[model samples]
Every structure is written in structure tokens, then in C-alpha cells.
Target: MEPLVRLHGITVRYDGRRNGGLVAITDVDLDIYQGEVVGIVGKSGSGKTTLLKVLAGLIRPVKGEVVFNNHKLNGNSFRVGVLFQSPLLLPWRTVIKNILLPIEVLGEDVSKYLSRALELIEKVGLKGFENSYPWELSGGMQQRVALCRALIHRPSLLLLDEPFSSLDAITREEMWMLLQDVISHEGCTTVLVTHDVREAVLLCDRVVVIGGKPGRVRAEVRVDFKRPRDLKLQYTKEFNDYVVMVRGLLGD
Candidate 1:
């Protein structure tokens, strides 16, 4: 099948105050297929987020091209949903209203997506909290609202930057199941940037590791675990083997 998105020879550089331009990533290439989850795992400065930014159209690469749906990316031409580490929900907006914020920003008719928003609220286990404010919810609940908001637009691609990194260990594990459920049902192509090797192995169809001073694709690991994978799978030797391999790639 043709790739849903492809990054060809991607390179990003930032101007340093004293050290001239710093190259974040060099000649990085990747392809994401429809309805597949791919994870980018790397150290703090390995350009995982930079690669995601390029895919999100939030950053223009210093070199190379990004092709989405077989066409070159052109200034927000494609529909994309992004979730960062922080939920970033508006304090005043109710859960349902917050999910509808994207519709409002896009100048679309809110009534048209009202039903979809409500369904998503239910989908993310926030059915009863639709009218609740962000402050009324727990950290995990707020992130659930953020997840609903990201899917409210029915985006073709979902870009996640460490979306579950902020939660406690138990909550993060719970979120892994929740996220797996959501992605399975929604069937959107996803690109996730995370430092957690176990998270990558647990949730991704493939893992791309970036390393070195000027970050580049150090290794790519294909995960073949079955769907609806249980947390018990995490305790198995097979699962840990993948994690250990990815950790090695990250130089952990």
C-alpha cells in the first residue's frame, strides 16, 4: 500500500546564539501508513519532536520534503490533530465545549459536530463529565478531554508528542489501554513522539529510534503484538526483549 505520509531526507536546523546553526536532525526519512501507529523514540534532544513538528506543518525543514497522501505538504492543507504533553485545555470551557473548540476555531458549524463531540466524550470515558470544567477533573481526566478534542475533528492524522508522559505510573498504564482502545476504534494514522521505550513497544506498530549529536534514524523495530494487548503482555520476556532492544538503540 502507498504510504499515508512520507518524510524524505528531512533535516532541521536552529540558529544558535553563539554556536552558529545547530542541526537537529539530518537526512531522516520515514513513512506512515493509514490506520497504523508509529512511534519515534529518542533522547531529549534527538529531534523526535522536531520530526513531529515537520509532519504537523508547524515547522519547515531546512532541507528535504514532506509528502502527505502522496502530495507535497502545503501550509496546513491537510487535516491534522495534535496532542502535546500538556493538556492545555481552557479552564473556563466545559468538557463538551472544550472538545468543540476546534470546530469554533475552524469557523465550522458547531451544531454539525455536536453529536460527534458527545460520542467522543463517551468514547474517552468522559460521558458523564461533559459539563464539567477542567479544574473539576483529575490530571488523567483532563488528558482524556484533550484526547477527545484531538479526535473531534475526525482528522486523517493524529500527532502525539509525549501525550501520556505527565501522568503517574498507574495512570499512564491505564492511559495506554485507553489510548489503544481509542486508536483502534477511530482508525486514524498516528505518529507518536515519546521517550518511553516500553510505551512504544506496547502501543506502536513500528518504532523508529533517533540518536547521535545530529539526530538520525539509528534503528527501526517492527512490533508484531496482537491487538487489544493486555498489560500482562508487558511482563512477558518477548515484550521486554523489544523494550531492551529499543533501549539499546536509544543508548539507555
Candidate 2:
């Protein structure tokens, strides 16, 4: 099967205060298949987010090519839904309005997307709070709204960077389940960039481990777990084994 998105020879560098530039990533190649979750895991300053930014077309690689559905990413209107560490919701916008924010930005018909926005709110279990402001919701609830906002446009790809890191352990677990359900329902291919080895092993079909100052793909682990996986699987030897393997690759 062909990849929905492909990155070949990806390399990024940042201009340091000194003359010489700092390389964030070097000579990385990646493939994201349709209807699969791919996790990129690494320690802080390991260039994980930099790689994700390359995938999102937010950062142009110093040397690489990004192909989305066989087309070059540049000069193309790529539809991607991104959820960051923070919910990043507008303080004044209501839940429904916030979900529709993407539509507004895209200059699409708001009325046409209202039903979809409401449907997403319900899907994420944010019903009856559609009119509530961001401040009114709990941290998890606000993230739920953010999830709704991300999927509002039915993006071809979903890019999540430390999305559940802000929540408590229990809330984070709950979100893992919720996200799995929503991704299955929406059939959205996802790329998750996280430092949590356990999270990657549990959630991704494949985990890519990155390391070094100018990060490069160190190892790739394929998870053959069945869909709709139970949280109980975490306690099983197989689950922990994958986690341990990924962690080992990161030199944890």
C-alpha cells in the first residue's frame, strides 16, 4: 500500500545567534499510511516536533521532499488538523464557534459547517456545553473542545503534538481511549509526536524513535495489536515489551 504522506531525506536547521546554524534534524525519511497512527518519540530537544512541523508544511526542510497523496506538499492546499500541548482555544469563542473557527479561517460557509461542528461536539462528549466559553471547561474538557475544533474540517491528516501531556494520568488515559474512538470513527490518519514511550506503544500502529543532537530516525517498531485495544493491555508483557524497546532506543 502506498503512503498517504511521505518524507524523504528530511533535514532542518535553525540559525543560531553565532554564525553557524544549528541542525535540528538530518537525513530523516518517513512514511505515513492511511488509517494508521504513527508516533514519533524522542527526548526533549531531540527534534521530534521539528520533524512534525516538516510534515505539517509549517517548516520547510533544508533538504527533503514531502509528498502528500502523490502530490508535492508545497503549492498545495493541505488540509491537516493539529492539536498542540495547549488547547489554544479562543477565550471568548463558545465551543461551537471555536470548532467553526477553522471554517471561518478557510473562508468556507459557516452555516454549512454548523451541523458538522455540532456533530463533532457530540462525538467528543461535549454536548450541551456548546455555548460555554473555554474558561468554563476543565482542562480535559477544553482539550475535548480542541479535538472537536481539529476535526471540524474533516482533515485528511491529523497532527497531534503532546496533546494529552497536560492532563492528569487518569484524564490522559481517558483521552487516549476517546482519541482512538474518534480517529476510528472519522477515519483520520494521525501522526503523534510525543516523549511518552508508553503512549506511543499503546496508541500507534508503528513507533519511530529519534535521537541525537541533529536527530535522525534511530529505530522503528511495528505494533501488531488488534484494534479497539483495551487499557488492560498495558499490564500485559507484550505492551511493556514494546514500551521498553522504544525507551531503550531513546537511551532511557
Q: After superposition, how far is residue 12 of candidate 2 from its true place, in Å?
A: 0.4
Q: Scored by CA lDDT, what does every candidate get? A: 0.93, 0.92
Model 1 agreement with the true structure over 77-122: per-residue lDDT tens digits: 8989999999999998999999999999999999999999989888
lDDT of 2: 0.92
Q: Which ten residues in a row have the lowest lDDT in candidate 2?
A: 69-78
Look at candidate 1 and give me any clashing residue pairs.
none
TM-score of each: 0.98, 0.98
TM-score of 2: 0.98
Model 1 scores worst on lDDT over the 10 consecutive residues at 243-252
lDDT of 2 by residue, 51-144 (tens): 8888778999889899998988884368999999999999989989999999999999999999988888898898899999999999999999
RMSD of candidate 1 to the truth, in angstroms, is 0.9
